[model samples]
Target: MSSYFITGVARGLGFEFVRQLSTNPANTIIGLVRDKTATEKKVSEELSGRKNVHLIQGDMVDYASLKKAVDEIATITGGKLDYVIANAAFLSVWAAFEPFSLLAKEPEKLEKELVDMFTVNVVGNIHLFNLITPLVLKGNGKKIIAISSGLGDQEMAINYELFQNAPYSISKTALDMAVAKFHAEYRKDDVLFMCISPGMVDTGYIDPETALLNDMIGKFMKYAPDFNGPTPIDVAIQRILSVMDKSSVEAGDGGKSLSQFGNKQWL
Candidate 1:
């Protein structure tokens, strides 16, 4: 039986991962969220009959909480973990549609946002990985997946001039690097670490009528005109899981930053 640990399962992609993985009664899915009661309610209301799903409270920015979560997960999974999906991150709406030039005008706010983003998106995941790695090492399936973004792709940014969401993009880039570092260290132990972009998933975060969003969409169209828009969360999660299932250290997937399609094609 495969045991999966996913973070930020209160909503969005994290919840979808648990939903899809729990379809198989053999898979033991453990979700980490900041609010255990709320997530447990969600599971009960939506995924009611799935006895394989479990929830634990943890916050990404809290080292002590993450450590406690690791301890709790070890108890639940018998000190072994098959997979880890680092899906929790900080996304700032204030900086979402602004370029660095505009964001630089408010240096104080920019600094705060950057620090918050990096703290959660990069450092927090690093701590979580380090803490849970022992459990992964003891398991049969040693795979760690970091949910990154296409905005992190330097080539895409340079080519399309996608200049919005500066802080978020920067943090995601750093997160991808962090994942690669983990892969470099753990591939020797047959652990597969990968950073995956789920493409543009429609998680109700985008408003089509917003001018800023339209401008971003225009930039995206220049890159891929056929890009209709973000895929559904369920479809995106399914594609990502498929990519994860097919990837392995022996297959040279370790340390790779891949799209849901299992390559660099973000859209």
Candidate 2:
């Protein structure tokens, strides 16, 4: 049996990934979520009859909790991790509301916003990967994938005003840089680094039927074309899992950059 790991399983896209992996007959899926009580309740109820799923507790902001989860997963899965996914990220990129309205204004907001953004998006991924790679290395294969956003792209964001959220974009860009760095550092380990944009998915972050719906719809579409095109999270999850199964890596592997729809050019 192949082993795989995913973070941020509380709801939205994360929850969808968990459901697909759990119901599938071929995969061994270990999913991590922030609230053990709530996530566990939901997962327990959902997968009560399933034998392929394992739900673990974790917090993106807490490194120790992440490490503990990593340790347990390594032990439970017998150190055979075929794919490790860094999927947890901030709900949105921008942090501050006033004084620095994605345009310009304050030193304090800039610092605070970017710090939090990077901490969750960049640092969270980094810490989790650092913990998981050893298990993957000890096992049979090595591949790492992270959920990425268009806001992180310099070339894409330059043309789109909707994606120009200061810290959110910066965090994602930083995440891209981290992926590149990990690819290089672990190339000898034969790790294929991958990223997915997930196409403006509407994981129900904001209600669509609420007032100002037209303006909100326009904004979401303008910013995230994927939000309108919105692939159901389960579809994206299956594709990602397929990518994990088909991808190859010899010791010291590289050149494995990709985006949401499996487009090699986006990275």
Candidate 3:
């Protein structure tokens, strides 16, 4: 049975990954969330009675907690993990384009925001790879997928002149580099490391109550007039997983930062 471990499986793309992957009876899926109690309702409603799915409590920002959860999974999965999807990330805190830019001008606040963003988005993901690499090495399908964003593409950012969501974008760029570096070092072992951007996905992480969201959407719409909004999470997840299923070192997917279209377009 293929064994998969994913982080941030409370409500968004992470939850969809667990749900979709567990559909196969031959697959064992382990889901990680910051708080199991907090996610109980969603888990029960969306993933109830799935014998292949297991829930684990952990936060990406806390390496110790993640380590403990990995230990628990090791015991449960017999020390092998086929896929480690680094999907947990922190972004909503300092996401607004203008406000985040203004906030970045402040020395102390900027440091805190940058550190928090990098810690959860970049450092934590790399740390997860460190902890799970051995388990992945033991599995039949050795794939480490980092959930990145098209906003991380520097070329696209320059072309679009997009400067909003700077903190999240910067962190994702670093994450993509880390995934590529990991692939460079581990491809010899037949361990595949890839990063894929899910494009614009509507997971309801954006608060409709926030006045700035409309402005942000307006700004986004300028580039692509056809850009209505994010795609449904399930639709995005299915497309992403299809790409992952077809990826391999032989197909030149290893060490690549791919987009939802399965190309280097970044989106």
* TM value for model 1: 0.98
Ranking by lDDT: 1, 3, 2
* lDDT tens per residue, model 2, 1-267: 567788887887777777876676677888888777887778778767767777788888899999999988978887568777788887642441222354346568678777888899999898888888888887665778887776567766555444335577788888888888887788777778766666556577645564534543465565555565456667766766666556555522243445554554332
Using Cα atoms with residue i matched to residue i, what is each candidate's TM-score against the true structure? 0.98, 0.82, 0.92
Give one digit per residue, the lDDT tens place, for model 1 in 1-267.
899999989999999999999999999999999888988898999999999999999999999999999999999999999999999888778999988899999999999999999999999999999999999999988999999999999999999889999899999999999999999999899999999889998887666678889888888888888999889999999899999999999999999999999999899
Q: Which candidate, 2 or 3, has the higher lDDT?
A: 3
**lDDT scores of the candidates, listed in order:** 0.93, 0.70, 0.84
The pairs that clash in candidate 2 are: 93-168, 187-252, 188-252, 190-252, 190-253, 197-260, 199-226, 200-226, 200-227
Leading candidate by lDDT: 1
RMSD of every prediction: 0.8, 3.7, 2.0
Candidates by TM-score, descending order: 1, 3, 2
Q: Pick the candidate with the highest TM-score.
A: 1
Task: Name the runs in model 1 displaced over 4 angstroms.
Answer: none
**Model 1 C-alpha lDDT versus the unseen true structure:** 0.93
Residue pairs with backbone overlap in model 3? none
